[model samples]
Target: MDVYAANMDRCPVYASFFGAMGCACAIVFTVMGASYGTAKSSGAIFSSGIIRPDRLMQNTLCAIMAQILSIYGLVTSVIISGNLVEKMALHTAFLQLGAGLAVGLCGLAAGFSIGVVGDAGVRASTQQPRLYIGMVLILIFAEVLGLYGVIVSILMLTRSTLGVTDCPY
Candidate 1:
């Protein structure tokens, strides 16, 4: 005889709260990161543009790269939010949280990397146009970090439908 209430197929209202917060976190943190990256890298644009105005468009790559991070977060948040149902399980909520956090934090990291590297790359390119290729490579690497997060979050989102009894372990 079980003394405590069996969680079985129970679907509590509180269970959905976590998923809701997760969705909010994904977009909020992503926007914050994109803002930071753009602001930090914009300085390089202003400084470098004065010397080599022709490369201003190329120098803007860093901020553009950083902004992609937020888009990833938005994608995942939408996926998670769409999955949210009236009878959400705890595990589903946790899954959303994990997905949201992964994308959001990764965005922050990508933003930081783009900001610093972009600033330096933009400045350097002003003096040496040949450095543009190297800057592209470095920015690509930084941008991929966010890609990894998006991919993982997408994979994690698949588990949202599982119920308590669905765990194999």
Candidate 2:
């Protein structure tokens, strides 16, 4: 018999609550970031479009890149949801929470960075086409920040277990 079996009180429905919160965090924070990025970049796109209509497509890439941040959150949330179990362990719940936070916070940061850079980059590049390459490079670097979060979250979630530790059922 496992020592944890004796402490059944330690295992409670709150475990599922934590896991659910994780899912919510993953979705909410990321979407917020993506939305912010999109709004900022879209404004820049319209402003820049007035100057150089021909470069509209190129500037649109900024908004598209911003949107990708939300996808990262979506993926993390789905994975965390899948890991949730009827009789979840506290360890697993914490793991899920960590995974969600890792992705959520990182994605938020990335999205903000992308939005600021995209807004400025798009506007500037419209005047000096030579700056387009630099803007793209910066965007790639900002995008990598979210990717790092996804990788970390995946690693954390992978360690979670769905085993029943002290559930009555």
Candidate 3:
């Protein structure tokens, strides 16, 4: 009877895990669509000169940064969800939260840097080839945040204690 009760308790937890996975998948697709739309719109505006070249570049950079962050968030969320389901342990939740926070902070910094440096690039691109080089540098730096987040998430997943035997189902 005790074993049966434990099994019954695990059922709802597993159900919630599956539900969260579905939600994460939805978020991933939504971000992809939004990123594509933003890119298309930015290109159209730039080609038509609807906005100043500098502003267009800045906007596009911001959109790209957003897309990168969203992709990282989606991947990390899926990984964390799998780890949580496997472990059924509380510490996994904290690790997931920490990773999420790291991604969010990185996104914020990237957005700000894009706004500032992107504007400058628009002004300098006409006279200097180095402007493009600087843009590349900024992009590389922005991407580092995503790398750190992934590393932290992997570390957490590796530390999870739950094994096949602990699974109630």
| Candidate 1 similarity to native, TM-score | 0.89
List candidate 3 segments past 4 Å from native.
Answer: 1-66, 84-87, 162-169
Which pairs, if any, clash in model 2? none
lDDT (Cα, tens digit) per residue for candidate 3, span 14-107: 4444435433543453354335434543444355345345545443653565466566667766765665554343344444555545544444
User: What digit string (tens of lDDT, one per residue) describes model 1 on residues 48-160?
Assistant: 99998998887898899889989999998999889776666778888899989888888888888888888898999889999999988999998888888888888888866
lDDT of 2 by residue, 88-125 (tens): 77788888899999999988998899899999999999
Higher-TM-score candidate of 1 and 3: 1
Give RMSD (Å) of candidate 3 vs. truth: 6.1
- Model 1, global lDDT: 0.83
Winning model by lDDT: 2
Cα lDDT, all candidates: 0.83, 0.87, 0.51
Steric collisions counted per model: 0, 0, 0
Identify the runs in model 1 with alpha carbons over 4 angstroms from their true place: 1-4, 8-10, 163-169
Candidate 1 least-lDDT 10 residues: 1-10
